[model samples]
Target: MTTPRPVDCWLTDMDGVLVHEETAIPGAAEFIAALRESGRRFLVMTNNSIYTPRDLSARLAASGIDVPEDAIWTSAMATAQFLDDQRPGGSAYVVGEAGLTTALYEVGYTMSERDPDYVVLGETRTYSFEAITKAIRLIEGGARFIATNPDVSGPSQQGTLPATGSVAALITAATGRKPYYVGKPNPLMMRSALNRIDAHSETTVMVGDRMDTDVVSGLEAGLRTILVLTGSTSRARVENFPYRPTRVVESVADIVPLVTEFAPVTGPEY
Candidate 1:
């Protein structure tokens, strides 16, 4: 019920906030367009590592929401950036799909099947026992472990499908090594996104559907959090959570009114 202060930037979650599975959420496109016209910076931040920013943008446009390639951030990009800074020149044993592999490769990291310096896990629909076994061996052999995101499952047309967390868990169980998470709910990802906007934590708003990741991460980062009920999170779930968002709305459509209420407009200048 508390009002959120005006923020300079909005970091959004894609899967449930903007679109549900393959369909775009109602009024999502128009809301984004309005925000754009108002000069309020916004970006799509997703834990899904199966697609690159460009791919995500294309998918969004196809789903009826027009977003630029640079306006999207994926766990894959964050993971690659982390690796680039933390483990430069180190070989990675990848068990992810094209997006993850592409990001790692773009960052000058070599992907290998054997004797890797790190084991990177992400969502891969083409997962195989061979891939899992190789990753386990590498981790057991003292390779550093990292997962793109900790999402247990992703929304799919058929329902929720297994995500990178499931694979990361299996690898951890087999190798007894915990992977460093590099996605939402993790401060590292928020920090990276904030850096991109050249904005401070206090001036940023993390808006999304999930409380465990998006809202918690924003709160931890000292950013305002907004919970939209267009995704996996329910109103009852938010009530049960220890922390609360700055504002709770039915969907992104409610954001405009909330923004106007929190920060009233004045007469326009020529």
Candidate 2:
């Protein structure tokens, strides 16, 4: 067998892997620092389309974790990239906040409500029936449907709130058109992340707390994966899946040392 390359680039999930709401997970800050100090290319990624990278960076800072704007990636950014690739300088009828809108604008996309190239959906706390109606109408009018992510719900101080996927379902039920999702579990998102960083799958590692989205997508994208128990998944839950991550750890604290020096995890099964 050809020898595997060392872990050089890292793509990590942000919400469960780093911080939980306003609190930073133990050693997550150190893990970020270690990657930075090691000069490794890394991105703190999230599926939430509500906040821009700058906004997310500030939020992380509030939790005592320091990550720069450029080192962050979001579903909104990925959606914009996908749209830009598929139809450069296109038009869209968006139902999202500044993050999604700014990304589209930065990519030279014109926002239109009439005969748009696409009807883009994203996460927002203020979604209303009127907004859903508009999106459904646009889709029925020949606008291709697109969504930032497939997360059905998002966490808040109060509890879980309906997310982009839930709204997408509502629109689908009305129009019978399924949207192209541009975030995690799409493997396209992982490949896009790799392209954004100029990372080779052989030399990159994906660290996440979700078996369904993170580990699965990373695996399908031909990258090594590490499942941490700091978020949505636990040890008992790992066996529920048919596949396995290259490694499983309690948290990011276990990975701080691997940032600078890691033996490539390259088993035949992995």
| Winning candidate number (TM-score) | 2
Q: Score every model by TM-score.
A: 0.92, 0.96
Model 2 spans with C-alpha error above 4 angstroms: 266-270
Q: What lDDT does the true structure give each of the candidates?
A: 0.83, 0.91
lDDT (Cα, tens digit) per residue for candidate 1, span 14-68? 8788897678998788777866777777788988888888888888999989889
> Backbone clashes in each candidate structure, one number apiece?
0, 0
Candidate 2: pairs in clash: none
Q: What is the lDDT of residue 107 in candidate 1?
A: 88
The residue-by-residue lDDT of candidate 2 on 64-124, one tens digit each, is 9999999988999999999999999999999999899999999999999889999999988
